[model samples]
Target: MSRTDFATIDWRGRPVRIECQWIDPERGAGTPLIVFLHEGLGSVAMWKDFPARVCEAAGARGLVFSRPAYGRSTPRAEDEIWDVDFMHRQAHEVLPALFTALKLGDEKPWLFGHSDGGSISLLYAARFPDKVEGLVVLAPHIFVEDKTVANIEIARTAYRTTDLPQKLGRYHDSADSAFWGWNRIWLHPPFRDWNIEAELGTIRCPVLAVQGIDDEYGTLAQIRDIAPRVAGICELLEIPECGHSPHRDQPDRVIVATASFITNNRRQTP
Candidate 1:
């Protein structure tokens, strides 16, 4: 396991702490650097050894971080409520600040994002096309769907009635901050119209959009709609017997596909 480090940054006028880790300390400078973005309720610890394993397989350096209000990072203010553009703010504001704080320099990273992280990766690549080399998104939501809202509503129930809070507490410093921040924003009525598909047209980096055949949160159209909009190549991977989290459901397949995608893209990068 990689040691966690803290970086303080001013996000939207508030000083927030972010938790980050280096997955491969000995990777060569020439190797591509990958940034792993976790799911909505995921923290650096929730990702566990998956990032390290994938980095090892791809022979790349990896950086995994917990967003503000999640994991051991700064917790959300008690009265705070996330707006509809919460994901947009994270992509446009928080991530740039993180890159600056980490001093990653001019290295163009290949983003490996899952769920909400995948959406953020897409938004980031769209906004800063030159900073990203490629993308491998698992179960990304280009737009909100009915099924997604339904699942999120169910999650709300589970969080309220079940030991879900206690379970998430194992990974998050303040489970309510992580869970409610993501859950409420997603279930908010206006969030139904929150879509980033139009922004994707600006992305020139190669994209590999993965979705499970039986994803409860989204349907195949989530990735299918992405292929035609991006300026660069868009590859789709539809895995059978997989659910919302492809990395956990089909780790071997995801690792192999991602490794191959990164290698091929690296050779093509100028």
Candidate 2:
């Protein structure tokens, strides 16, 4: 599929830009819509073509976009360090505002989120239960872990010493600003106290959670904590030999799992 251009949306009483990248299949006109939300350092370009593949397999429409302050969207302020509730803002405010602005809220959309995006998906589903069809999360984080902090520290080192930032620049307009803002907030002392397990109970949609068994940043505990909290249904799938980014490490497995999850949920959901 050819790449789409960037678009802008005014938010927070300011001109906060965002990119909407989607794959519209010809097979079905009213196919289910699944919105793709990227990880902490991810952009629409970094998602590569996984969104297209998943949508093709499931016969669904995909709405993939870069959030504000990431990718080709607006850059973050130099002094900005995200709060632990950053996911909350994305879920409750940014997402709703964007969907409404783009007139995408008319159709209920499923959420496919990874890492920080996964947590944001959870928050969105919990806060707006009626607007969600289902959720497919890849390597989501609901609580902080020591291993997560350790890996984040390593990423900081890599960004400074290696070509990580330069490589990210190929995908994002202001890769340095996005990378540093996310890194600093995650590494901050106050963020260490962050946890949102309490808020997940409000999610009344079917959830299909996937995580790699070998994930360096998180363990099964993150999904385990929210599995029982959800009033809807929650199914956890652990992919073997997979790491932090399951979609990157095991794309085929993720595609199959997500496709099946959406298909099965849509048919039987109440």
* Winning model by TM-score: 1
TM-score, model 2 to reference = 0.95
Candidate 1 residues 152-242, lDDT tens each?
9999999999999999999999999999999999988999999888998999999999999999999999999999999998999999999
Model 2, range 1-270, lDDT digits (tens) per residue?
Answer: 534656666665578888878687354446888889999999888899899999988888888889888888888877666787787888988999888877764578889999999999999998999998999998899988999999999999999899997898998899887788789889988899898898888899999999999999998998777789999989999989999899999999999989888888884323
lDDT of each: 0.92, 0.86
Per-model TM values vs. the true structure: 0.97, 0.95
Model 2 global lDDT (CA atoms, 0 to 1): 0.86
Clashing pairs in 1: none
lDDT of model 2, residue 196: 88
